[model samples]
Target: MNGETLQLEIKDNIACITLNCPETLNALSMRSLIDFHASLKQVIASHEVRALLITGTGRGFSSGVDLTAPRPGLNPDDPDELLRDYFAPTYQLLKDLRIPTVAAVNGVCAGAGVSLALSCDIVLAARSAYFVQAFVNLGLVPDTGASWLVTQAVGSARATGLMLLGEKLAAETAADWGLIWKCVDDDKLMQEASAIVNKLAVGPTTTYSLIKRLMRDAKNNSLRDQILLENECQSLARKTEDNAEARKAFAEKRKPVYNGR
Candidate 1:
């Protein structure tokens, strides 16, 4: 499904969802978030889609929620109401996707935008791109799980500094701090992200999903618990057709051809 605010296209087992409102730096207007959820539903229902990639068409990935334009039902004055009604559903939907996800940050990523970027399984940003934790500047705290995400990625010290200072973090610095997977040149952002998504789309889909689940829960798991979870996941992964093909290809000295079983 296509909408004025967001665009969705699926091909070659990869589902690409682009934020289309470049006018506001791909701001998450209520209309855009609604379209985003619809697109996500379509992606989730598609058995043929193996991987998902998110990006925006403009000089910024997303500047976060549009402060100037409030939706008819959402109340910006009430942060709890805004989070419950608008942000939580979309964030939970994206987080719950049982597929590999990559967020290709083309330019500026700030406020809730930073949370969106970190929500993905992997994040690749253009070297020229920057992340801003501008919530404090607006006398607000981070929402959309940004506090947990940033703290998990860079530890509480850095997260606290970032949340309090609200400084602009360069993409390179972000990568160095383990905030993103990598930093590429501005011109190569799409190319690199496409290559990564394409590779994941054709790989062992079951294993990738399990990996996502495992890692997502790792913070709450002890080593003993994680080992048990890994063992359980391995048993499930071994039953997939892709795993059999991978074994057969190894025996035959050939590249594995996965059908995303």
Candidate 2:
């Protein structure tokens, strides 16, 4: 699926979603968010896609919402409407996707952009890229799940500082603070992200899906409940064809080939 502000391409079982509006540093307008939500639905409905990667063209991953962009019938002055109608659903779709999701941050990720990147299962950023909580600068508080996502990754203290100060957080520092999976050189960012996505695409995708669910549920579950959930998930994983193939391959002393069943 493709649109003016976004592009979606699937190849070798991996789906790549690119933010195409580079002129404004890939700042997402209402139209772009609509396109993005549609593209994600396409990915979810496709059986051929096993892994998903999100990135952007030219310079940045995304600079967040374009407050000045026009959307018919929507009140621009009321941020609540936009968040309820667009941003909330999009982020929920991403979080609930059955397949693994990766984000490649190529440049500046500010405001909601930071939440978008951090929402993925794994996030990799270019060494030169940085994140900023730009909302405070506009006299607004962080929205689009930033308040929760940031606080969950880093501690409350760091998240508070970032949001209140609206200072740039370097990619390397983000990694060190456990906000992202890794930070690579600018030229190698795509390469690393592609490598990770490709690996995930060919692995036991059913297991990955279960793992993703378990991790998300773990945040709110007590240790006793989490253990039960893991046991249940493991039972499900063990019933997949890929698990049988893995056992057979182990006995044969050869690498297992997964069909992502």
lDDT of each: 0.91, 0.94
Q: How many residue pairs clash per model?
A: 0, 0
TM-scores of the candidates in the order shown:
0.97, 0.98
**lDDT (Cα, 0-100) at 169 in candidate 1:** 95
| lDDT tens readout by residue for model 1, 1-261 | 579898899998999999988989998877887888889999999988999999999899999878876577766587576667768898889988888999999998999899998989999999999999999999998888999999999999999999999999999999999999999999999999999999999999888989988998799999999999999999999999999999999999999999888
Cand. 2 TM to true fold: 0.98
Q: If candidate 1 were superposed on the true structure by all CA atoms, what would the RMSD be?
A: 1.3
For model 2, residues 190-211, the per-residue Cα lDDT tens digits are: 9999999999999999999999
Predicted structure 1, TM vs. truth:
0.97
